[model samples]
Target: MANEKITEEEVESISSFARISLDDDEIEDLVPQLNEILDYFDKIDEADTEGVEPLFGVHGKKNVFRDDDVGESMSQETALQNAEKTEDGYFKSPRVRD
Candidate 1:
């Protein structure tokens, strides 16, 4: 990245590692696009955010947990009524191999 000159050997090794097959034409086309993307990230690294607080939400956050409360749960009859399949008081679905 110092000179933005990634060698053909490096490119070949990366391609092999990723198990990707790219002909000479594709590598020629990707060289500048990859270089441009890297340059953009490099430029962004120069930003000044001295006192900025890191944000997880654009809107301010509220409590992420609920207060503990004792409650009665829905009956199984009501729960299985909405299911596509129910047998022996349990939801049944297709078996997934993986």
Candidate 2:
């Protein structure tokens, strides 16, 4: 067999750190799959990116939010008009805990 990039012991350690319970069969299966994923990352490392500018985000627009201008404020009577239950200018709800 070719050189094993990830051993069974390493898989056990990773599963323990991730708080995951893995049987012997699952650990055996994960060793090869994790090594394959690492190999793909190795291939990606070989890519040429000398002159390429780092892209922070896909969106072209920066700070697309409207101005936070204060407008006309609603009266307290108008705000509590549609409430099913109101107590002293605030909405009242059922008791959450004993």
Candidate 3:
């Protein structure tokens, strides 16, 4: 894996695909890091997990919640009492999209 070096052209191609611009210095720095990552993956591929079951998660957890029962509702005025802005008796929020 150490002999399998990453080329500048490959790095440039990857940067172009990712929409990131990389100078010569940055590309040189990334070559080693990327090669190291690939080497780590190669090591992982050689691991002995023949009988090991794949784990979806590390922790055994479950959701805990109260029963969803209908409750009393607040008045319109009460609901908008703390709003910074209102329009036509409703909470007015800023426009987010064109």
lDDT for each residue of candidate 1 in 24-87, tens digit (9 for 90 to 100): 9888777777777878887998999799897878778666778799899999999899999988
Question: Of 1 and 3, which scores higher on lDDT?
Answer: 3
| Order of quality (lDDT) | 2, 3, 1
| Error at 33, model 3, angstroms | 1.0
User: For candidate 3, which ten residues in a row score worst on lDDT?
Assistant: 56-65
Count of steric clashes across candidates, in order? 0, 0, 0
TM-score, candidate 2, is 0.57
Instruction: Write down the lDDT of every candidate, Cα atoms only.
Output: 0.82, 0.89, 0.89
Candidate 2 C-alpha error for residue 65, in Å:
8.4
Model 2 sits at a Cα RMSD from the real structure of 7.5
Q: Which candidate is the best by lDDT?
A: 2
**Model 1 stretches astray by more than 4 angstroms:** 59-98
**Per-residue alpha-carbon lDDT of model 3 for 56-75, expressed as tens digits?**
66675556578999999999
Pairwise TM-score winner, candidates 1 and 2: 2
State the weakest 10-residue window (summed lDDT) of model 2.
54-63
* Candidate 3: RMSD to truth: 5.8
